[model samples]
Target: MKLASYADGSRDGHLVVVSRDLTQAHYATGIATRLQQVLDDWGFLAPQLEDLAVQLNHGKLRHAFAFEPEKCVAPLPRAYGWAVVDVEGSVRREAGQFQGPHQPLRAPAACEPALAVITGDLAAASDAAAALDALRLLTLAVDWRLDGDLIATHCAPLAVTPDELGEAWGGGRLQARLVALHNGAKLDPRDVAAVPGDALARLARLRALRAGQLAGVSLGALELPLAPGDSLRLDLKSADGQHSLFGAIDLDLAPPPALP
Candidate 1:
């Protein structure tokens, strides 16, 4: 099941179910209005959303519409927390700094690709296996840093349920390449060396990692310089190089404001 958030002026946008190929979508209107609501009640709400996804994918829904990435926000526009472990094994948890689609920002210094997981409520000390079981959705991420500090993190337009990856998701890791495109050219294909387990295991030590909280493991090393007016597209391709798993993080950074 693939899910997204359509911009609705509110902090949490309207929930949407996207097709596997990511070309179409159906509003999860009656099922749920926000992604966080579904995450809060996954056991009851997720299956319904899954059914809608099936209908949307098969063109059985009459109200399905074109999936527009430009009109998207972060999957969880207001997540409980955003915890990320960088290549240096440093873990940082902060209020979510997320963007989607064409949202522009100040010029970013460097862009690094990553894979993120949205996990359900997890108790402290939960091992990697347990952490894996709590995983809800998976998506691609781009870490845009300035002066070695995380300036922004762009999440792919759509997030898919872990099972959506099929064989690509195994051993608590997503066997995929975090592909970053600069101006339509491949800048770096970050074969995520920091697997989900690496981040999950580190996060497990925390007192509690609640639902609606996102965690990620960045690509081990490498940063692609992104200049002002640069366009960056971040997505995940199957390890075997078959297809795109998540939608994409298509961002364009605006040039810095002129001096007064």
Candidate 2:
């Protein structure tokens, strides 16, 4: 089932269930209000959301609305545990809020295309197999690695269940290529080999652990420099390389706020 969060003048926007074709949506008002809430009660809430997704996809809902990509915030506006491991292998806490794909970004030095993994409760010292089982959703993300430090992140509009990935997901990593476009031009597609198990293990190893905490993991390799007024699109394709797996994360980088 595909899920998106629409901007609603709140830190955690309104939750909506998106259609399979990415054309329509319906507010998940009665089922669950926030993505984090669902994550916190995955066993009970996900199946309900999945049922809604099915109904929306099949045109069974009467109040469904057009899915607006531009009005979304990060699937999880603020993750329970969001962090990135630097080149030196140190887990740096990326505590800032995540921007939605269409959200204007304060022009950064560069953007790195990546596959982000959002997980459910995971036990510490979990192996790859265990870690893989804990993964719940997958989405596209653009990372800003400033001087090797994680500065900011822009997440795609929708987050898909791992089952949506089909064969692309295996061995605790996304075995697929990430396509990146900069300034309306296609850059080299990056073959992703980022193992979430490795990253999560590191996170558990370095700090005291918590159960049922949701963490967004980014493992990107392609970096493209940018300036204000530049635009970017990051996408992942199906294993057959025919269509987009998660919808493209399209961003129009905006300049930073002026001095007061």
Task: Assess every candidate by TM-score.
Answer: 0.92, 0.87
Model 2 misplacement above 4 A? 86-90, 206-219, 255-260
For candidate 2, give the lDDT: 0.75
List, residue by residue over 9-89, the lDDT tens digit for candidate 1: 988899999998889999999999999898889999999999998888889999999999889998886778888788788
Report the lDDT tens digits of candidate 2 across residue range 1-260: 89989999988999999988889999999998888888888989999999999899899999999988888998887886666664456665666468888766665655655566777877767776766677788787777766777677888888988776678876566677777788989887766556766766677664533433434445545646677788878878865556677777887778666789
lDDT, model 2, position 124: 66
Any residue pairs clashing in model 1, and if so which? none
| Whole-model Cα lDDT of every candidate shown, in order | 0.80, 0.75
TM-score of 1: 0.92
Candidate 1 lDDT score at position 226: 68
